[model samples]
Target: MPARFMQMQEVADELSVSVSQVYHMVRSGELPAIKVGGRGQWRIERARLEDYIERKYTETADWVRENPLIGREDEIDPSD
Candidate 1:
């Protein structure tokens, strides 16, 4: 059985990102989370995390569609 909710560190580990990044997402409203317990620790629902991942995939697909690299690959600067 899986947990219904996950701590900030767990979410970060699942997403392969830093814990601070998860905090920023929650703070900026990019990722939905809830504060619980006396210490006010943040917890993200498993469903919500899955939704965020799906949304990101959609957003990335849209961005790729809008910015096709077909003939403009040379325009990108590798040094940057």
Candidate 2:
């Protein structure tokens, strides 16, 4: 079956975030979406979104492989 897609507004509303947040999600590639036609409407596939969420969760599973608190030893801590 063909994948069903949702607009940026729909995604934002479903996620309970702002439209800008949805845009940022697309920009960051955290949310799998596509721009359709020349108008460039941000449309996300339900399967793609689910896949993205799964991929993210799986990717983060390695963080605690050593120490959960240890994040980017070279980068400055944001809380500091």
Candidate 3:
């Protein structure tokens, strides 16, 4: 079974972003994470990560709706 919680580095790898970027997200409250251990390491729950991804998709959809690109839908296929 996969881990229920992931380390900061693991979250970064999963998102294909830098570890520092992940830290920024956590610090900024864009991504949910909690510090564990006496060493103060950050851990993210898998469910929260999934929620963040879903929220991003929703945000992108809203942006696309609000800011439609001109001629995007009518663009001809260059391959044709």
Candidate 4:
């Protein structure tokens, strides 16, 4: 197989999350990772990370649509 793997720290930094969060992701199987050689080390696929990011974006967009920004009609007035 190819070296399509990223360290937990790198992934954590990229996601702006704590290492424990990344560990939780690996533990919960949210991120595609593998523990190899009887070690607790975790490695995630870059593509899987990208997919997770895309999913988050989609979810955030849906949430924004459901809960529109807080503003008023006067915020867009013509006769100001």
After superposing candidate 2 on the true structure, give the runs of residues whose Cα lies further than 4 Å from its correct spot: 1-3, 55-80
Which residue pairs in candidate 2 collide? none
Candidate 4 clash pair list: none
- Which stretches of candidate 4 lie above 4 Å from their native place? 1-3, 72-80
Number of backbone clashes in candidate 2: 0
Task: Please give the distance, in angstroms, between residue 40's alpha carbon in candidate 4 and its true position after superposition.
Answer: 3.5
Candidate 2 lDDT score relative to the true structure: 0.80
lDDT score for candidate 3 against the true structure: 0.94
Ranking by lDDT: 1, 3, 4, 2
- TM-score pick, better of 1 and 3: 1
Model-by-model lDDT, in order?
A: 0.96, 0.80, 0.94, 0.85
What TM-score would every model get versus the actual structure? Answer: 0.88, 0.60, 0.86, 0.76
Q: Pick the candidate with the highest lDDT.
A: 1
Tens-digit lDDT string for candidate 4 (3-79): 57889999999998999999998888877788766667778988889998998899989997998747755575686
Between candidates 1 and 2, name the one with more favorable TM-score: 1
Q: Name the weakest run of 10 consecutive residues (lDDT summed) in model 2.
A: 63-72
lDDT of 2 by residue, 1-80 (tens): 75499888877887778999989989997787888999887899988877876786877786656555565677757785
In the range 1-80, model 1's lDDT, one tens digit per residue, is 89999999999999989999999999999999999999999999999999999999999999989988998887999985
Candidate 1 residue runs with Cα over 4 Å from true position: 72-80
